[model samples]
Target: MSAPSTDLTQEKQRFELLSQEFENSQKDYSKFIAARQQLEAQLQENKIVQDEFALLKSDAKIYKLTGPVLLPQDKAEATLNVDKRLEFIRGEIKRAETQIADCQKSLESKREELLTLRMKIQGV
Candidate 1:
């Protein structure tokens, strides 16, 4: 009958809308994942930089505090530069970690929303 046809059409439209929403969510999720990956890579690079800086600091400390007085002025300047760079890298790592956390949270929320939508669509 016409009533059944109308219901079918409405249901079809609802399904189409849901499908579109799902696709959009999927795209958003992918973007979140990419952002997380970028943050992680930045964090790793910062860690490496931090490690190198730490090694430079240790070397400078050994030369200044324990070794002979042959340490040159340039070495002292380089040590200060390394210290500043280490601090900057540490700050960058912290910011990247926060960004990664935010991306993870967004991804989780999107996944949950997608799951709920699927369940609703399935009449579960």
Candidate 2:
């Protein structure tokens, strides 16, 4: 009876410890998921900005050439304006690309953290 009682006590303690560890892992995973979602949103925003920039670049090219062909002097000024806009868009695209790279790094880090936690929990 004593042996049985001791075994039961040890089992209960082990169970409790395991439960606590599972809870902690759950919390950490939750946080990681949230961060991943935010990173995904930012990536999406970056993609949208990139798309917008591409469209703006296309518009600038079209207008710059058409303006010059149709109305030389007026088109020259318009082309200059379009060129300026294109330059601005290019700069914005570069910035967005940089941000995307940063987000990817953060996402990878979070994934690695989650994987490490899971492996630790599994006793691997």
Candidate 3:
């Protein structure tokens, strides 16, 4: 093969590889976005739980959901559990956001490379 044909083949291979990487990254970002949304929903529900627990009287009756049964549970402990869950969800949200940002940066960079490669191929 001529030098130019060989170079073109290599560039074409690189272009396909980069395209696949872009698609994979896009899928990862989509998954993270869905996870973040789910976490946000859980956080909202947990907030409602926190509010409900806060409004309860110290002596008010509460129940823990044991499978097939509502077992009596301390109000304070339940409130604390809900608070912990909310904090955990908040941390997850922050992490997910960070991952999303990184993924976006990678995606954009790969896109620019793809565009350059396309132009290169066309010029050849």
Candidate 4:
């Protein structure tokens, strides 16, 4: 009913909202980290494949595993496919990194806001 009580109630509501936001940011950050890790792993695997391809002779036979069958494939085609996949994976990695950085910044900002709100609530 009083002004101080009303201010305190508002502060408490703000704190609750901020807490929820912080939790959501944390979850997003975690998901981005996992995605980045998986992308890194894929990048590593693709690099290895590229290296192996480099060592193979131009006339070397290539077989692509399609479902349960090993279908004969042209070495040049396979190499091109791997190169394209590497490019795609690299782009995805960059995107994931950006998302991760953004999420991290958001989390930090939310944490500071939440801390400040908590202090304000306690003071009230």
Candidate 5:
């Protein structure tokens, strides 16, 4: 009947919309994963630098590369800067992790919605 046909058509439209949404969520999830990975790498590198600082003597000459110039830096100051950088990187990593987790949840929910919509379309 025409009523059944109408229901089928509506369900198909809904399925299409859900499919698009799921695709978009997948893209967002990928982006979040990339960002989280980059943040983790940065955190690891900073931790390595922090460890290196421990091997250096207090009076060791340290230089900071600022663009094209190597500026002399006091060891204490450099260590402090590295410590602050590590803290900031750790905070950023936590934030990225949170975003990744939230995006993963969104992706899972959208996937479920798409599957349900597919079933409805088939039934119609």
Candidate 6:
């Protein structure tokens, strides 16, 4: 029932909440890293596909599979499809990288806040 005991209890609660928030931010950082890595991998694969497409003969045959049927496709169309896919992948990679950067910034802020909270708790 003492004022000091009540203040101590409140401080402890705040410290615990900050700790949980910091932990969640760390998890978000990990997820962002993984997503960025996956996007980079996809980008690399698409680049390789573009390179291989460039090496094909002018009259090379292209086909698209549609449920067990190989539908013939024009070389120009195939090239366009690859180009579009590469463009999309590049955009996704950029978006993922931006998200990773944002996540890092947030994590840094949370870390600073957690440090400040810890200091306050200690002072209390």
Off by over 4 Å in 3: none
- TM-score of every candidate relative to the true structure: 0.51, 0.47, 0.96, 0.96, 0.91, 0.84
The lDDT for every candidate, in the order shown, is: 0.61, 0.56, 0.94, 0.92, 0.85, 0.82
lDDT of 1 at 88: 66
Q: Tell me the deviation in Å of residue 31 in model 2.
A: 0.7
Tens digit of per-residue lDDT, candidate 1, span 1-124: 8996776676666667756765775676576567656656665765675466566643454233336555544455655755676576566657656765665676566567656656655667
TM-score of 4: 0.96
- Cα RMSD (Å) per model? 8.4, 11.6, 1.2, 1.2, 1.5, 2.1
lDDT of 4 by residue, 20-89 (tens): 9899888888899999999999999999999999999999999999999999999999999999999999
Please give, for residues 12-120, the per-residue lDDT of candidate 5 as tens digits.
8888887888888788878878887887888788889888988999989999999999999998999899899888888887887888788888878878887887888
User: Per model, how many backbone clashes are there?
Assistant: 0, 0, 0, 0, 0, 0
Better of 1 and 3 by lDDT: 3
Q: Evaluate model 1: give its TM-score.
A: 0.51
lDDT of 2 by residue, 1-124 (tens): 7996676676556556655655665565565556556555655665564455456543353322364474333434554664665566556556655655665565566566556655554557
Candidate 3 lDDT over residue span 1-124, tens digit each: 5999999999999999999999999999999999999999999999998888888889998899899999998888888889899999999999999999999999999999999999999994
Best-fitting candidate, scored by lDDT: 3
Question: Runs in model 5 with CA error above 4 Å?
Answer: none
